[model samples]
Target: MSVKSAAAKLFAKKIYKKTQGWSSNPIASQKNVLNSLIKEAKKTQFGIDHHFDQIKTFEDFAVQVPIRDYEDLKPYVEKVVKGEENILWKGKPLYFAKTSGTTSGAKYIPLTKESMPYHIEAARNAILHYIHETGNADFVDGKMIFLQGSPILEEKHGIKFGRLSGIVAHFVPKYLQKNRMPSWETNCIEDWETKIDAIVEETFEENMTVISGIPSWVQMYFERLQQKGEKTVGEIFKNFNLFIYGGVNYEPYRAKFENLIGRKVDSIELFPASEGFFAYQDSQKEKGMLLLLNAGIFYEFVKSDDFFSDKPRRYTIGEVELGVNYVLIISTNAGLWGYNIGDTVQFTSLKPYRIIVSGRIKHYISAFGEHVIGKEVECALQEAMEGTNARVNEFTVAPQISPLSGLPYHEWFIEFENEPDDQAIFKEALDNAMRKQNMYYDDLIVGNILQKVVITKVVKNGFQDYMKSIGKLGGQNKIPRLSNDRNIVEVLNIK
Candidate 1:
């Protein structure tokens, strides 16, 4: 190994050793984080208003602060946007991470000085943990291509606003800065298609070892790279080993990604949001990410089934159980109190508190009472594609709700890179897989309550074109895999 590679290995080893204690006692670790946040924010207006001074325990904290979504917390966020101090955090946020909203237009989430480090640290630890687990640190010696948004942040009322990925790019460590690909000018292009083309031109010959981004966008880059070089990604970037991704489930795209790369690389899943960096995959041997118990956020879980019910039961980190879907509720240093980020996750392990993101609470199909989540849909799709030559490029599902149609059924719009020879058999395989996974879906089909799923083969780049038209084609923007309404389906013009 070269001198730089040796140094990287040492750095990774050191980070692994230092951060191992963070998840030692998951319950106690989270409680300590919560206590610190509560004590620090107790002097703020929000803290005072929420009786933070009286919150001596988790139970006290939960009782004093009610669960709230983005809408519920908008008043305080608006104040922050207007340069109000101590409205949410102790002072105005360092920056605002603007999330592209599907139903709620747009949301500006705070990124406080206290909370910013957690985002940076979580990403750093994710790599460290990967190196520790796999004993692979050569990636650090080569370039890393982070498929990020424009780093040129927009200033509004003295607060910067941009995609979280772009904001985080500003904080890439000095050491890694030398090894990071795609110049700042390329990243600042704003348009994803234009930006990706620039990135392809700039990094096509770089010694790329790591690539990080939402799967969809990175996949686009890979496609472009292959087109230009007429070589698989593995042939182009021979040293590429680690792919860190989040924002969407990677399973359904796993086969497609492997085929594009021409080999399997170490994959790490992360649960990073505009709200906070929550978890990171710590072990290759494990299925889920190790929850960051000592991070700036204090987590609460409400059973997904009970989330919409009156007086939903909330569970603290210690109270969470393995295998149950829970809507994640968070109280963070960024001034969010009992905030439901809308994502649902299930604990895969309680020992060190590891979780797999199940789905988004808002992104589900339950039109006929057959509630199907993104995870279930993804799994079903993966199963359907098994023992077949089919490779999915992109897909989305929406409920076909029309009283005139006799019976409601789910409609799937999919773009295939390699089409299945027998389309009817492919559709049947997906239907059978769905029935096997969800009893409600099975009953709906068997009892003739709902018609069989309708599959629509979308034109190439159909979803991409839809997103581009909306001016939200990149950086954290994702096509919701499942929706109760046909908003996306209509936009994509999928019949």
Candidate 2:
């Protein structure tokens, strides 16, 4: 190995070991560490004007940098997309991550040198968790299947460049480069229509031990695998052990993947965006994840109520109350300060900084006019799945408006493990769970909001097929579960 590669590996190992047991929970340790880090950041020229240096207390940081959504940074993103220097960071950014959000009119977040390390390190931690989970850390660690986006960016008026994924691929360390699946790294897709085809062809070629990317894309790959009559991982790559997913909930697509692989592949959850990788699945234990606070950002959470209420109070890692749902906010070295990423998560524990992604503050269904968050849907699904051979791989609830009452009704499309003989019981259980968990749903069912729940059993790989149709097959990709707009629902053929 070259000296740089050797040193990189050594450094990675050392940091992992040093921080591994520092505290059973990294969450409790964040306050002191953050306060100290802020103190040190103040010493830097960048943090000086940013007020990181001036803020001593948590309240000070909160007051100094108010909570900001993506809309707040549109002008900054425009500048970054135009390749302007010093819009949010010191140097020219490597690339812009283009992401679509509800309130933000298209975001192109800048990824700078100072902020890249956080993403790299957090992602590395996610891998470590996978290694621990599969207990196959020593397995043929030859190549990892990233299943990520290629760099083929579209600029204004035919002025195009490689996409951010392509740019990041080039910048990844060389040693790690060899570890990536050739299919994921290669920019072969010429357009959106061919992207899924290119990805499906690539995935079948390797003995991918560690698979990473969005669940929706992964599901599409597996759907293609099955369509080709490939049944088991051993049939393609015998040593495959892990499935790393993030960007969106995998609940809808999880079962099909497990059953098709015919092996319990270790699963890892990652919290990443165009901005940076924030937290990752610490599969070393159960429930909650180890937040990568030390990465190129300082993290904060505001209670879900506070995030939506007229008065919102932000809480530091140390200040987070256990079991309460909060919206994630981060101030990164990449120049995104006090940015609310719109994810709703709750602390399962405080010591290690483990959290559960409850739902998106914006990504909920209440078209029936009854507010239903992701957590409520998850609970209802879990309850509904009880006493049946059926297991839901992935699911989404769309509200269908009634012409007569002009009220919204919920239509559930679920991908099941095994198609149940009796659908009515399952539907009843789901309804009962919904009414129990959400008073709004109860009110709707009893009165005027939404009259009844409509349940549909799709082909085991229905969601996967939808993703393939969309041509978004890999990398930081996920199908939105609850979109306010009907375009996605109609396209997916969800009733």
Candidate 3:
């Protein structure tokens, strides 16, 4: 083995030893992390306002700090933007990770010197854990290409603001800088299409072994390479073996990716958001990501079913149960206390605290009380595509309320890479899959309260065109899989 590969293997072993204790005793590990966070932020304004000194336990902390979403915490965030010190964290934050907003324009999540290391460490440990488990360290000897957002950050009152991926790119370890693709100049191009063309031109012949990005964008890159050389991605980049992806579900795109690569490769899923790095796929044998219990973020869960209630019951890590859908609440070193980032997750395994991302709290279809989530839609699509040659390029689901001449129904706008042979049968299969998964939907159909789901085969690249028109074409910007209303569908001009 080469010296770099041997050194990476040793480092992977050390990371495994350091992180294994959290799996052995998750509750204790979480408590220690929480205590450390509380102690560290005790002098901040939020800390003093919440009486942090009097809080000695999770229960105390919970009762003192009510759950808050972005709007609830916006005032303090504004203060921080205007150069306020100790408003949320100790001193001022180094940067703000801007994310899409639900009702507001945009959200700027704080990124402090103390919290930045946690993001960097979690990404490093994800790779190290994969290496330790698989004994594959040769990837370290080759280049890595990460498709990220533009790194040219805008400044507001002396604070930097940009996409999370862009901000994290600025902190890529100096050692890895030599092997990372898409030079800083290319990464700073704001237009994704222009940026991706530049990236393709630069890294087409590099010895790339690891490629990381959201699955959709990465798929776009792969398609571009195929068009350029008239060869499969595996043929073009023979050394590529590891595929790291997050920011979206990979199931719907898995078949398309495998087809593009012309083979299967090792894959890992991560649960990193603008808020913090929460989980990583530690073991290939496991179905879900292992929650980072010892990370700087302290975790809490509220049953997703009860989230709309006036007072939802909150569960600590010790109280979370397997298979229950829960909305995650977190208090992190970045000074977000009891904050709900709006993503919902399910505990797939409790022993090691493994979880699956269920959906977003705001992204669901309940127009006629079906209450379907992203997980259900993804699974239904996966099942419908089975035993067929159909491959999804992109899709979105919305309720068709006030139809001109029929009962209300769910509308699916699907763009396919390869259209199914029988469109009618495909539509029926999709409806049946959804009915089988959601009892409420089945009952509504049986009771004649709702019509059958309407499937619209969109023109190729229709969804992409829509995203581009809205100036949200790449880097964590995704078409909402489920919308409670038809606002998105209307904008897409899907009658």
- Largest lDDT belongs to which candidate? 3
For each candidate in turn, give its C-alpha RMSD to the true structure in angstroms. 13.6, 14.3, 13.4
Q: Roughly what TM-score does model 3 have, to 2 decimal places?
A: 0.76
lDDT tens digits by residue: candidate 3, 12-53: 999899887778898898899889988988899999999999
lDDT of 3 at 9: 92
Count of clashing pairs, candidate 3? 0
lDDT of 2 by residue, 1-495 (tens): 445434545554665675565445555455554565565446443456567756777678777767787777666656656666555666566556654333323456766667766667677766654544444554334467666556556564222344345556656656577676655435445443256556557767665677776654555566567666556654566778777777656665567577777767667787777767767777646787767766656788888876778768777776788889888888776677788877788888666677877866777774433446666777778887778887777777776653355434677777777766788887888888878777546744653435567776666567778888888766667766665445565655432
What shift in Å separates residue 34 of candidate 1 from its native position after superposition? 1.3
lDDT of 2 at 470: 81
Q: Against the true structure, what is each candidate's TM-score?
A: 0.76, 0.66, 0.76
Provide the clashing-pair count of each candidate structure: 0, 17, 0
Scored against the true structure, residue 320 in model 3 reaches a CA lDDT of: 89
For model 2, state the Cα shift of residue 375 in Å.
Answer: 22
Residue 59 CA error for candidate 2 (Å)?
2.5
Candidate 1 ranges beyond 4 A from true positions: 102-104, 364-495
Question: What's the distance in Å from true for residue 152, model 2?
Answer: 2.8
Model 2, 298: alpha-carbon shift in Å? 1.2
* lDDT string, candidate 1, 97-135, tens digits: 976432344678999989999899899889887877777
